[model samples]
Target: MSFSVEEGEFFGILGPNGAGKTTTLEIIEGLRQADAGTVEVLGMSPWPRNPKLLPRIGVQLQASSFFERLTAREQIRTFASLYGIPAKKADDMLTVVGMEDKAGTPAEKLSGGQAQRLSIACALVHDPDVLFLDEPSASLDPQARRNLWDLLRSLNEAGRTVVLTTHHLDEAEALCDRVAIMDHGKILELGPPATLVRGLDSATHISLATGTLSLPAAREVAGPDASVTDDGVTVTIATRAPAPVLTALADRNLLTGIQVRGATLEDVFLHLTGREYRA
Candidate 1:
């Protein structure tokens, strides 16, 4: 519940449904008041809805609501105008989010991914010092998600602080300089993704195409301690001692399509939060 983000750092907050991720973001963004704690952004209080703070931070919520009957271009221009930004700056933001081609298209007619891009463009139109994104890629397709990732990276590299809340562990791992993993409205872990993952006493997973090696053969090479599973399409072996298993597989010429994966942020998340569905 108590943590600090360094200036210009890409910090991520991760949690399942009802875990207070959005509530935390709202409080930090001056949209909601905290019950009993001090909060500061840019060395100023946010709870009173400081007008000065509004111009320094940009927020893109999970559900974006654009002005009625506005095109992509007009929507962002309106947002820019509110901050006293010029129309040319708004147009540049559209291009920044790759929405220039859809600029003239009505917001209602844009696809979900395109709409997300527009929302991001609107948030960035003012060129705020900090940006807040709540599940920005929640419903985006793979390509759109990757594209958004690139855009976010570029923004951070340009010296803008980004505070993101997402359920996608991979996105956090790939984008954040540090992350906070929360559950039951409390932060359970906080650290760099690699450091958190390395602290886990978890097994490495080795996988291959199903037909490449028989399950029985893989199990034999993997040994009794290692767990092996074949789910038709892929055969996976989980082992604490992967070196010996890999050496055995190499000796037997059974390494085709082999993929070795170390512990990842997802593993760290599941270990801290437990394996259960969240509403």
Candidate 2:
């Protein structure tokens, strides 16, 4: 329940639906009040909100609202004017988000991903020191999601602190420097992706394709503490050590098209949460 995000770090908050991810972010963003917990962001209490701190942080909510009839350029310019940001800087932000080509296009005419990028552009128009993204790539296609990931990486490289909420385990593994896994309003786990995934178990996975292989025979050959599953040709062996299994299979002339791999975050998540990360 208590945590801190260091400067220039890409921190991710991950959880399933109704896990209080959005609620926690809303509390930090000064949009919601916490009854008991003490919250500090950049050395300021986000609840009794500081006027100066508000302008120095950029926030992209899960959903946004804008004048549908306004062009992307006009929308940015309007936000800039409200914040007293220069017009040229607004255009530059639009260009940074790859929306310059669509600047003349109305918000209603923009695609979901494009509109999301424009929302992010507006959030960054004032050059804030901290950025919050709430499921920024939720509706985006794979390539568009990658583009947004690259943009966020560039922001982090430029020394901006980013706090993001995501349900995509792979995206968290790829983009986060450190991740906090939350559930039921509490932090269940926190650490770098690699460290967390490696903490699950000291085992390697070996997969093989042999066309309707025998699961029981494979398990017997894999020895104790190892498991084998066969699904009509595709076989997967989970073992604490792969060398012994490989040797046994080789000795039996059963090791063909074998591949050894390490555990990933998805595997760890499934092990801990008892559910697949579908979002």
Candidate 3:
């Protein structure tokens, strides 16, 4: 429930659905009143509706839409005008987000990724000190999502403080300097992704997918403590030393897939929360 994002840090808030992330963002954005507790952003209190802080902060909601008839350039220009900025800066902002090629395209005709980039352009048009994005990668394809990640990193490198929420644990691991895992309006874990994941009981995970017939022998080699997935096709061996486990499983030719990796954020979350992350 309490955390602070350092200046120029790419902070991320990660949680499953209905984890109060949206409400938390709204409160910090000065769009909603909090029942109790102090919320400070950019060294200014976000409560009581302070006019001076609004202009210094930028926010892009999970879903963003512009006038259907307006081209991407026009939409950005309109926002620039609202912010008392020059129209020429719209083109500059478009280039920043890789939307210059689509500037002439209407908002209604733009792809999901293009539209999201335009929304980000609008958020940056005012030149705010701090930017907040909620689930910015939602509905984007894998390639588009990765592209957005690159854009966000570039923004951070250019000296912007970005706070975002995401359902993808991999994104949290790759993009965020520090991540807070929240559930039911409370933070269940908080730390850098590597530190949090490394705190798990097992240092590594050996995952293998096999048929029901191989489950018995797989568990035998994996030991009594190995975890068998609910579907029984997947068996995971957790240990710091995976050599013996790997050697034992190598003899079995029924494995459809096998992988050995360190404990991940997802593994830690499942251990802590006793459930899979649902987004």
Candidate 4:
């Protein structure tokens, strides 16, 4: 329920449904008011919706409604005008989000991914120092999702702070410098994805299909987080360094049909919440 993001970091909020992801984002965006406690963004309270702060922060919601008849360029220009910025700023932002080629396309004609990019363009048209996104890649195809990641990374590199909420663990792992995992309206874990995953012990899961051998507790080889699951003598162990465990098991001729895989953000999530990131 509590965490702080460093300026200019790609901070991600991750959680399942009913985990308060969108509610937290809405509070940060100044669109919703919290009944208790205090909230701040960019050095000012957000609940009151400060006009000065509005121009310094950009927000892209999970869903956006655009003027269907307006060309993407026009929509962005309208936002630019609202901020008293030059209309040319719209073109620049569209280019920044990789939507320049589709600038003239009607909003109704753009695909979901393209429209999401346009939404981001509109958000950035005012030259905000911070960008907020709620599930920017929610429905994007794999390639589109990757493209969005590149855009976000480039924006951060250009000195814009970004805060986003997403359900994609891989997205958080690949892009966020640090991530906060929430459940039941509480932040249960927060840290760099790599560190959290590595902290899960083996940082790798080894599954071996042994024909008829029984092995010592995985906890003995790895640690408490290490465990074994059996399917016809197949044992799975979660560990940080597999070499030592594998070598020790090999000494007993207990290794068979071994498979090794590295840990991931998904594993960390499951470890913390005992549930999948279905939400």
- Winner on TM-score (1 vs 2): 1
Task: Summarize candidate 3's per-residue lDDT along 206-265 as a digit string, tens digits.
Answer: 776645336567667777656544255556666666677777766765344677788788
Report the CA-based lDDT of candidate 4 relative to the real structure.
0.83
Q: Which candidate number has the best TM-score?
A: 1
TM-score list, all predictions? 0.96, 0.90, 0.84, 0.81
Backbone clash pairs for candidate 3 read none
Candidate 1 residue runs with Cα over 4 Å from true position: none
| Overall lDDT per candidate, in order of appearance | 0.92, 0.87, 0.82, 0.83
Q: What does the lDDT come to for candidate 1?
A: 0.92
Output the TM-score of candidate 2: 0.90
The whole-model C-alpha lDDT of candidate 3 against the native structure comes to 0.82
Better of 1 and 4 by lDDT: 1
- lDDT tens digits, residues 1-279, model 2? 988899999999988788888999999998899989788888888887679788889999989888869999999999999789999999999988888899999999889989899999998999889999999888788988888889999999999999999978889999999999887788888999999987987578788885535777777877889888776767888889788888887887766667888888777666756684534
lDDT of 2: 0.87
Which parts of model 4 have CA positions greater than 4 angstroms off?
207-241, 244-259, 276-279
Worst 10 residues of 1 by lDDT: 249-258
Error of 1 at 219 (Å): 3.1
